[model samples]
Target: MTSPHVAALRSVALNVPDPDLAAEFYTEVWNLAVADRQDGAVYLRGTGPAHHLLALHPGEQTEIRNVTFRARSADALPVLAERTVGAGGRVLRPVAPVTEPGGGVALIIADQDGRIFRFVHGDAEHDVDTAAVPDRPVRLAHVVLNSHDVSRSQAFFERALGFTLSDRTRMMAFLRCGSDHHCVAFGDSDRDSLNHIAFLMPDLESVMRGGGRMKDAGYPVGWGPGRHGPGNNAFNYFVGPFGVVIEYTAEVLQVDDSYPTGGPEDWTWPPGRIDQWGIGQPPTPAIKEAQQAIRFMPAAAF
Candidate 1:
C-alpha cells in the first residue's frame, strides 16, 4: 500500500479551560479574526483562505483536541482510510460531507500513537485582504510535537502519511508535506504533548511588529527572535493563552524532492547564532516549567 497524501496543515483544535480567553488572545493579539463562535467553541481565521486556522473548544484544562490536515482530493480520503486501517489507525468517523466554514467533507482518525488526525477535502478558500487587515498572518507554518519516542512518531508520520523528512537536529526532526521546510516536526519528550504552533509572518518586520504588539498586551517573548539551524527560519516566540507556546516565523527554508536528506546529525545548513544577529535565547526556565505543566484534555469532548 502507499502512504496517505496530505497537502496542508488545515487547523488545530484545542480544548482550553477558558475558551473565551483563548479566543481573545488569538483574535486581539495574533490578529486572527473570529470567523465564527457558538456556546462552547470559537473558530478563528487568519488573512488566508481556509475557514479557521485555529479552533478553541471548552474543556477542563488546556490541551490539544486534534490536528486537522488537508488531503490531496476527495478520492484521496478513501485511500487514506484504507491505508490507515492497514497501519492500525482506527477511523473514529468515516468520510462524510461537511458544509461548515470551509465547505468540505471531513473525518476523524487516530494513529496507533494516540494523535488524533482529522482530514478534510474540498474546503472553501479565502482571499486575504491585506490592505484591510494589517495584522493578518501569512499562514499556519508548522507544529512541533513532543513525543515519547521521536523516531517512532517520525516513522509513523513518514510511512503512514506522505510526509518527508526535511531536516533533523540532535533533539528534533522536521517533516514536510510541501515545500515550506516542515509542516510538522517532532521533539524528544516523555509523553505526547505540543511543543509549539507556528504561524508564518509576511516578513522580518512583521515578526518584530507582532512581538511588540504582544509585549504591549503583557505577553513577552518566552524565547526567540532567533534563527534556527535546520529550516533557516527567523523566529520570535511567545506563550499564548493556556500556556501554549506560539511562534511567529519568517523566511522558512523551502525544499523539494532534490533537497538532500542527510544522515544522523548531517543537517544541511551550517550552525549559526541561535539568533542570527548573535543575540536572543531559548525559553526561560519559568516558561519551560509552564509548558511541562500541561493538563490533560480528554479525547472525547463532544
Candidate 2:
C-alpha cells in the first residue's frame, strides 16, 4: 500500500476578472490580509505566515479551478513531482515556488481534471488581520471538489498526492491530507470545479457574527450557519471574492491511525434533518446521487 503523504493545504489560485474587488472582499469579509500582488494575481491570507492563503489570478474563469498544498520539505517536492508525471499526470508547470517576502518556495501541478495545484515548502504561521475586527479564522480548513471520476480523483490524491480517508457519504469522500478531518473532499459529479473552501473559526457565535458581518458587507449568506451531520462541523458558506465558495466552520470530524480506514466513505444527513443541535427546522433536500452543482445543507444542532 502506498503511504499517504502528510501535506498541508497552502494556497488556492483562482482565476478572476477583477483582482481589486476580489482582493478587497477576501481581506474584508474573509478577514484574510492582502499579502501582495503580482502582475495580475492578488494573494490574500490570514496571519499564520506564508504571506497568503488564496491568490486571485485574474482570468475569464469565474470559479476556483486550481488548489495548492505545502509539502513536508523541498526534498519531498522532487519525489512527488517525478511520481506525478510517471503516473501519467501532466506537469503543467515545473516544481518551483514563486519568490515572496516571506521566503518560501512552491511548485504547480495539475490534477486529472486539469485543476492546478501549487505545492510549496515552508511553514509561516498565520496571524489574524486585526485591521478589521478579526473573525475567528482559526485555521485554513478543507476544500471540496466535484469530480467526473471519483476513483481517479481518489487515486491521484492517495497514490501520488498523499491524502487519507477521513469520512464518507455515499458518493462524497472526505480526505485528511495532514491533521484536519479532511483538507480536501471529492464527490462524483458531472461538473469539475471547487465546491467550497473552508476556514475553521473558534465557535458558533463567531460564525454567526462573521456571517452577519459579511452580509452587512453585501455578500449575502450563500449557505449555512448550520452544522454538518457528516463532519459534525458548525458551518457557514458565502460567496467570496473570485467566484469562489468560502466556508467558516469549527470542530469538524478529525482522525489519525486510530480512525478505521476502508469501506464506502458514506455518511448522510438523514432526510428532513436540520441543525445538528436538533432545533426545529425544515429538512435539507436530497442531493442528486452525483450532480455537478453545489448543494447547501445546514446541520441541526443535535
Candidate 3:
C-alpha cells in the first residue's frame, strides 16, 4: 500500500452549546460564509472553494469534535486508516462517506489524548466568494491542539500521516503537511482541547481589515496585531463563543523539502518570540485555562 500523506488542513468541527449563536459569531463577526446546513449543523467556507473550513454542530457543552486534514488523494484515506490503527491509535470511525454537508470519505481517529482527527478525501469544493469587499479568509491556515502527551501526539502525526516537524519549542511543536509552516501543532498542556484555529488572509491589510470588522461587530481583539517569531505571520486573536480562539493571520512563512527544521534549543527565544512586535500582555489566565479546558464531551460514535 502507498504511504498515507496529508496535503493540507481541511476544516475543524466544534460541538458547542448553541450552534445557531456560534454560527452567527462565525458568519457575522468572523466573516466566514455559510456553505451548507443540515440537522442543526452548519458548514462555513472561506474565500477559496475548499468546501468549508469550519463546521458547527449541536451540543450541550463546547469543545472540539474533530480536526480535519485533507489527503492528497482518495486512495490515501484507507492507507491512513490502516497505518493509524496499526500504530495503536483508535479508529473512532471507519472510513466511509461523510454524511455531513460536504461530500467526502472521512476517517476519524483518536490521538494520544483521545482528541478526534478526521482525515478526508474527495470533498466537494464550494463556489468562490464574490463579495464586493470580501474579508473572508483565503484559506484555513492551521490548528493548534493542547496535548496531554505532546511527544506521543507528535510521533503519531509524523508516523501515521507523514507530517514533517518544522520546529519544536519547549512547550510547542510546529508540524507541516505541505509547504505552509504548520497545518497542525501541539502545545504542552495538562489535558486535551483546542489551543486555537488560524485562517489566512492575502496580506497584512486584509488581516487588519478583518480584525477591524470583528471589533466593530463587538468582538474585541484579545491579543496580537503583531508578528510571531516562528512562522512570522501577522496576527489578531479574538475569542469566539465557548472561549474558542480564532486568529486572522497573514503572510506565513513557507518551507520546501530542503528547508531545515529546528528544536527548542535552536530557536530564537525572547525579544517577542510569541509576539515579534513586543505588543500585548502575556497570555491571560483565561487564555491559559482555555488551552486545557474540555468544552465538550465527544459523542460515543462519529
Candidate 4:
C-alpha cells in the first residue's frame, strides 16, 4: 500500500496540570494568542493561518496528547488509517468529524511504540495576523520525539505517513512531509517521549529577542542561539513551566525530493560545539531531563 501524503505539521495537544496557568504563559510570554476554549481546554494560535497551534487541557501532570498534522487531501485520512495498521501501528479512532476547535475530519493512530498522532483534513484556518509583532511565532516549525529505536520510528513515518528523510545526525533523524526540512524528527533515546516543540520565529533577530524575553520572564535559555547542522535553523530553547521544552527558531532550510540526505558524519561540529555555530553552551541538565519527561498519554485516554 502507498503511504498517505501529509501536508504539514499542524498543532500539538497537551494535558498540563494547570490549563489556565499554561495559557497565561503561552499567551503573555511565548507570544501565542488564545484562539478558542472548549470543554475546559484553551486553544492557542500563532500568527499564521492554522486554526490553533496548541491545545492545553487540565490534567494531573504535563503529558503530550498527540502531535497533529494536516493531510494533503481529505482522502488521505482513510488511506493513512489503513497504512498505519499495515505498518504495525494501531488506529485508535477511525476517520471522522473532529468536534474540537479546528473542525475537520481527523484520524487518530498510535505507532508501535504508542506515540499518538492525529491527521486532519479541511481544518479551519484564520486570516494571517500581520500585526508586525517582532517576536511573535508565525507557526510551528517542528516537533522532536524521543524514540528507543529511532529506525523503527523513522520507518513508521516513511511507510505509514509518507515522510521523507531530510537528514540524519548522530543523535537524531530529521524527516519531512513538506519543504521546511523536517516537520517531525526522532531523537535517539532510551525511552519514548517528547524532546521538544519548535515555534517558527519571523527571523534570526526574532529568535534572539525571544531568548531575551524568556530570560526576563525567569525562564533562561536551556540551549542555543545557534544554527543547527541538519535543518540550518537558528534556535533558542527554553524549558518552560512544568518541564515542557519549547524553542523559538527561524530560517529552516527548504528542500525538495532532489535534496541530498546527509548522514551523521556530515553533521559533525567541532569538539565543544553541539550545533553548526560554536558559540552557544551545551544543553543544560534541566532541558535534558525535561526532554524525556513528557511522554504520550495512553491510547485509552483518547
State each model's CA lDDT, in order: 0.79, 0.66, 0.80, 0.91
User: Which of the numbered candidates is closest to the native, going by highest lDDT?
Assistant: 4
Q: How much is the lDDT of residue 81 in candidate 1?
A: 79
Residue-by-residue lDDT tens digits, candidate 1, 1-302: 12347888978888888888888889888888888877678988887777888888888778888888899888888877777777777787789986456668987787776678889998877777557454468679998878878887888777667688877776788898888888899887787888888998888888888988999999988887787777889888888887888889888998887888655556433474444555787678856766555533444532
Q: Write the per-residue lDDT of candidate 2 for residues 1-302, one digit (tens) a residue.
A: 22344467766666677988877777766777777778778877664554667777666556554576777778887777777786657676676555643446666666655666667776455554555344646557777888878778877887777777666666777777765677788877777656777887766777888888888988776656677765678887775654467788887776677776544533434565655664423322311221234322111100
Comparing 1 and 2 by lDDT, which wins? 1
* After superposition, candidate 3 runs with Cα above 4 Å error: 1-4, 130-134, 271-273, 299-301
TM-score of each: 0.91, 0.82, 0.93, 0.98
When sorted by lDDT, best at the front, the candidate numbers are 4, 3, 1, 2
Clashing pairs for model 4 are none
Candidate 1 vs candidate 3: which has greater TM-score? Answer: 3
**lDDT digits (tens) for residues 16-133 of candidate 3:** 7888888888888787878899999988888887888999988878778888888888788888888787777878888899888888898888754567888888889866676625
Q: Write model 4 residue lDDT over 1-302, tens digit each, in one string.
A: 12247989999999999999999999999989999999899999999999999999999988999999999899889899999999999999999999998898999999998889999998999999878598999999999999999999999999999888989988899999888899999999998999999999999999999899999999988998788889899999999878899999999999986899999889876777788777887899999999999989988777
Error of 2 at 165 (Å): 1.2
Model 1 CA lDDT for position 91: 80
Model 4 CA deviation exceeding 4 Å by range: 1-4
Could you report the Cα RMSD, in angstroms, for every candidate shown? 2.7, 6.7, 2.4, 1.6
- In order of TM-score, best first, we have 4, 3, 1, 2
Best by TM-score: 4
How many clashes in each candidate? Answer: 1, 32, 1, 0
